[model samples]
Target chain A: MTAIAGKQPNYKVAPPKSGMTIKQQALINSIIVNAIVILLVLLWTIPTFGLLVSSFRPRDLITSSGWWTAFVTAFQSGAWTLDNYRSVLFADAMGSAFLNSMLVTIPSTVIPITIAAFAAYAIAWLEFPGRKAFFLVLVGLMVVPLQMSLQPLFSLYQATGLNGTFLGIWLAHTGFGLPLATYLLFGYISSLPVDLIEAARVDGATPMLTFTRLVLPLSTPAIAAFAIFQFLWVWNDLLVALVFLGTRADVAVLTTRLSELVASRGQAWHVLTAGAFVTMIMPLVVFFSLQRFFVRGLMAGSVKG
Target chain B: MRSVQLNGGPVMALFEKTWFRVLVSLVMIMALSYGFMVSTEFMKNQDAPRAMLAIVAILVGVLGIWALYLTVDNLVSTFPIRIRDFVRPFVFIAPAAIILGVFIIYPTIRTTWLSFFISRRGTGVVPGSFGLQNYVSLFTDPATFRALINNALWLVFVPSFSVSIGLIIAILVDRIRWEKFAKSLIFLPMAISFVGAGVIWRFIYFRATFGAQIGLLNAIVELFGGSPQGWLRIEPWNNFFLIVIMVWLQTGYAMVILSSAVKGVPGELLEAARIDGAGEVRIFFQVIIPFIMGTIVTVTTTITILVLKVFDIVFVMTSGNFNTNVIANVMYQQMFVQGNFGRGSAAAVILFIAVIPVMVHNVRSLKSRRF
Candidate 1:
């Protein structure tokens, strides 16, 4: 099943001879496929590429001309500048918002993985009452609209003074992230060799020791995958941050801050372009660096039950 | 504590007693909760060094939970062996269950309850205001009606477009040498937030009235001697434009999954189809697609759920202006902007109801796989 013969040059089906040989037909087919794929790739990338180019162009140039114009004058001294990024980072206070995103994202990722790993181990291995029912309910909860929980959670936060605090957002992210984390981890933990777990038990390893020493190490790939998913989700989240953290400058993360910039300065493309890239830069780095693990996590988390 | 053994003296025997162990567990839980409260209180203090306080709070919250779990697990071990087996699972599961119950399960119930009442202001429901008035008005209101229609359009277009485009790209890219690089470029947008994507597309859809036309679309139009257009102000079609952005961001996700599934289809099966005189298109329809139908359903439903709750795109690009209101954005408007709790909760409940079928399907599939 893993063999992908279609990628090979020699894997073409023989076409009935008409005006040309079968080799020529295969060549034509390959060229057509490559052209179409390249065109689609360009279509998918140009929007992001436009903004990226615009971010580096000077403010006057960005407003007065198309980003494509900068490429015509690519080596000219006046074509590019760091002024937009400078103004965005320091003048617009995205620097603090960037830090705030980190503060909110890290603990949110760690706490959920920690909590859900324990729960997944229990659900997978332990002889618990209602284990099947609990697992089923968690699966059902995976698709529950976050909108359903917004108002009441906001009310609860207001009552408890969790609204607009770092602690509140952290706990809120953990709670919302738990169902998927536990479910994904459970899939991995349950599929571990059963005899390995039984071996530890027979050798007098306690559940806690077994989990820490054996399960945790063996499950690093699953744990790392969920960490990236949760990290990206929390970092890029807007609704949760808006509802729980509000648009308060001190607590605003990158999404809330960037959205606020869009609202208040819709015409300021210079700042908006740089500001948008600022928010995107981290996720892009994580994506390019950890694309393999991210894709594995996405498939395991979504495609499988 | 590590030095102590099961063979220790009477003092250890007291620790092993079921009643004493239960007391210790309860005390450990309360202590953890107390520590959390105190640290959060410290966080609430404005005079404290903000970063330091945040760090301390994180340490306390994380460490405190871990400490509670360890203490409880240890206590469970001292119980009779049969009881320990059962109690230990609950001990492992308690934190997750409590948080889910409090954060997700309870709020869902409360939101449903709130939908049954009326609240002009978000303070609380009015006395004697128990009825279906909120839902009735929800279905009747003009603005919300537009939102419902837009949501329906999103539900139809986003998933179908994303899945089809992704599937085509998956199949085409697989036959090429630079498959990984091309896939990464297409999939790059998935790393971007919806708000950031909105900003990126705003540059494309940006309309310049009196300039060289910085937006690419406007630039192309002007290059052909046509005037720039305010693309977002056009009614109904503007909704389609916004939906396009979602498709752009989500197509990569669908592509990645569908690509893997396409690769998983057996090479022998394709060869067999070719031997039977089936063309490539015919083979794709007959052999390849049917082989990955399960994955297609999975990708479609996943994208469908995302489309159902789409908010950031509309919220950022137009704030639901120009007839682009979706259910989630309208729910935000009623609840937060208008401070009308009842209407908002009713809107939220509509989203919840829309997702129920997907949820049930997911649970059923999971059960079938496991049991």
Candidate 2:
């Protein structure tokens, strides 16, 4: 891993930098970079922004003009209304779906994080046999698509009578979520100062005590990161919920409900926009509030140990 | 057992024994398991009051495990070091293991088995009809073949574009003052649900029969005097349009990751390249890219896996019609819409097979990074 300084090949020099001579080149580079970056940012953002604007415009106005045109027309005509929100929230029963989403999401997020935290603590700190094997299995499990688990999982739910319950979706999410949860927490936990755990052990604290009192307290950042991640994941998930917790109105979460809304009312842009925003609000808030941890988690997911 | 004479009563002395601690843990585990099973039954019956009661019971069950552990210190003190160490990890690992085993591992094995069975509507997997018929049909069916080709198209296009676009953005935004703001804007879509993203992009790709095309893409095209096109329904090209949504959603992820990796490149090396008369392109290709090659590969593979499992966009945007069917979406249709569990399971297994090599590469690269 040592840097091989002398063995490096050197390219032939073209010329010495005439300080002022490069100024024009630097200016041109800056212009190109700024232009490209701005274009990219606009391209990345305009779709969502369009939808956001369309959500705020009147239903008739939305269908008649592009969202961009709403700036001129809707403002001139005073056509913006809260009717889409009213209809989506009340008439479309999205309010119930929103609550159902929360019920399914909170437990699903918490259960996996709790279980993964314990497993991560042990795998990271404890002296245990089959530890590497356990970790490798988790890493391997990360690639097992949720699609693969649907049919059998449904039957398992049927056998256990959990097919259409909130708890059923929660457990299904927990199972699907564990691999990444454990992997990320383990990465964060293993990198923690080993001496902290060792010092706890030296004081005769049991593993459980050290975990709760020491590791859990200190691992809050990683916990928060994984918590946000799992929350957003379970919140955004459509497949798992759709499979285990059928489309029963009593149990259907926001996604299944929203997708069904799309299926049934495909061209209803006004309601769909409002509904989409409602579904996105919580995750967006979580993302903005905890942007740092979210970015860190993304980095950890890709740039692994 | 060496019983230390203590001022406490016989109850305290009994609690001090290793076997007593073992007995307590065993009883606590059994009780927790029983409560878990009972709560699940309540869940199945859809008994509302009982379901709420089950939550309380489960909470008490979890708390009991915590309460048991709070008292375990003295119990473990009596055990020999070998015995104590051997059992400790299990106490922490068992909950995760049981959940993963029952839900993930067991289901995976069952899915593979079910793939060999015949599709029976409603009930799933007709017995004695077991064979490779589903897999056989998976290869032969034209629609399935088209889905496979579409998946291959996704595999080729999505990752390459996402990684390259992400890398380009990462490099461009590096020296800018608004790096954080720019990155956040790009990463914002990652917060949007796939279903939500589908809705957002539907506006962009929206088309109509006549009059001042409302969708941005068509608006721009029409503004230039080109006719409005139904972008999503145009076959083959439709798949690419759907992929654009994926790329738009994912490029930010790749950017956030690769941006950090680019920041990690040594300043001295870039200076050295500049001094050696390497132009921006030369220096980028030789120095910067090589240094961040590992991250690029990681990002590519990560996005590749995402592209393979892409369902929501197809599911929401077109429901896999207009020749946009992907493996995962097709599998969903078979299992849920068509009620053909065997065929669906087979599609899922094919997906599983597709993801393995990428996962292995990821694991190997990660393993190498450890040292």
Candidate 2 C-alpha error for residue B206, in Å: 1.5
Instruction: Give one digit per residue, the lDDT tens place, for model 1 in A1-305.
Output: 32555454444456547878766887999999999999999999999999999999999999899999898999989889999999999988899899889988988999999999999998998877798999999988887888888899888888887777888888888888889999999989999999999999998998898898899899999999999888888889999999888888878899999999999999899999999999999999999899999877666655211
> Ten consecutive residues with minimal summed lDDT in candidate 1 chain B?
B1-10
lDDT of 1 by residue, B206-270 (tens): 98776779999889998999988899989989999999999999999999999999999877888
What DockQ does each candidate score versus the true complex, computed on alpha carbons? 0.63, 0.49
Clashing pairs in 2: none
Best by TM-score: 1
What's the C-alpha lDDT at position B49 in model 2?
60
* Candidate 1 docking band: medium
User: Which parts of model 2 have CA positions greater than 4 angstroms off?
Assistant: A1-21, A74-77, A302-305, B1-38, B45-82, B122-130, B210-212, B362-371
- Give interface RMSD for all predictions: 2.5, 4.0
